[model samples]
Target: MNSNQTEQGIRTLGVDIGGSGVKAIVLDEQGLTITERSRVKTPQPATPEAVLNAIASLASEQGEFERVAVGFPGVVQYGITKTAVNLDPQWENFNLGDALSKLLAKPVKVANDADIQGLGAIKGQGVELVLTLGTGFGSALFIDGKLVPNLEMGHHPFRKGETYEEQLGRAALNKIGVQKWNNRLQRAIANLEHLFNYNTLYLGGGEAKNINFQLPESVVVIPNISGLLGGIKLWQN
Candidate 1:
């Protein structure tokens, strides 16, 4: 709430673009919440143009803001998307940062949604791994507050010819029932622990709310709002 922020002290309008919905929230320079979260259903077909329109509409409901931070459910590189994953193929290679900056008339930064989530969840020390289990599995790794680029760990092999995402995503949970899905998640966690040896692990995304078992001392479940909190940090150098 100072000169570094907007006239109203709003620093950034954070947008989280997921497979099912587009959500936005306003935060001040100090990372204090400045507005109620607003959400819009992701359009049918979920094409780039459709999602773009949805984001614009969602942003409009949040009043004024100086900049934007977008958490996209895809492989985003320097604001350019490299993979579609759960989104439309048209998103591949799309320069999303440039597109949103132009559309919203505000500076924009975009990154893998899970990576943004990690920014809000991590203590910025040791190796931290964040996994989001929703429409799809999303992951991000960080060490001492620095991101190690993007890791599409979800698509990596897990079981017999199926990927981790294929086994742990929301669809898998609904199709297999909660108990079986939880078993798959247990195995996934053990596998990830052995592989990454992370100091902490954070579970997030919409479906994370349904987790019914206790996690290890080092593992924690974070709310999806962490992704919006990350938008504030996204502006930091």
Candidate 2:
């Protein structure tokens, strides 16, 4: 956490729901929030029951708040989840928004995990595209200040026997060398370029924070807070 971050407001609770764990943050209105909010490992089978239980647990630690925002590793339609690539395949039919709001007893909004990060990076930036190369490749698109969630373009076809994740994810980087990883990443970005034609790109995920190679001139390495910050925005929705 950055030093200046602690000096802000605390009316919001933001949670980033990932395949690994659920991270919670209690922030003031001015954005001052505790860094070590709360966290717990996510259930491997990520059934709706288990994921909601984890969220309730984290909220218990932060007490009450005006709203709650959760980042799901899948597609969401008015709060219903449609996927979680790394967790339970059952998440494909989750009513995450209603489930979480019931659990928290407050307004709740769930969005794609990658969009959470993208939100933090380009929340106020009218139009942008974000790609997160974490345990897997996650992506989100924004246009005219609105979020278009669950764009599973990561699963779109790429090089031989390779989906976008196979070529651009961290696991793939570990399997191949950085040089090859960059090659695949460049290709993957090319896909986004052709499909979305986005002028700006925000890159995140645990791995992208350390990208050393020269990326596209329009690409920006966003801080991880985009996920958390995006959660805050979702909470207000």
Q: Which pairs clash inside model 1?
A: none
In terms of TM-score, which candidate is strongest?
Answer: 1
Q: What clash count does candidate 2 reach?
A: 9
Give the number of the best model, judged by lDDT: 1
lDDT of each: 0.89, 0.76
Compute the lDDT of residue 55 as modeled in candidate 1: 89
Angstrom error at residue 85, model 1: 1.5
TM-scores, each model vs. reference: 0.95, 0.85
Note the residue pairs that clash in candidate 2: 8-32, 9-28, 9-29, 9-32, 10-27, 10-28, 116-227, 117-227, 120-226
What tens-digit string does per-residue lDDT give for candidate 1 at 45-79? 88889998998998888878899999999888989
Error of 1 at 147 (Å): 0.7
- Measured by C-alpha RMSD in angstroms, how accurate is candidate 2? 3.3
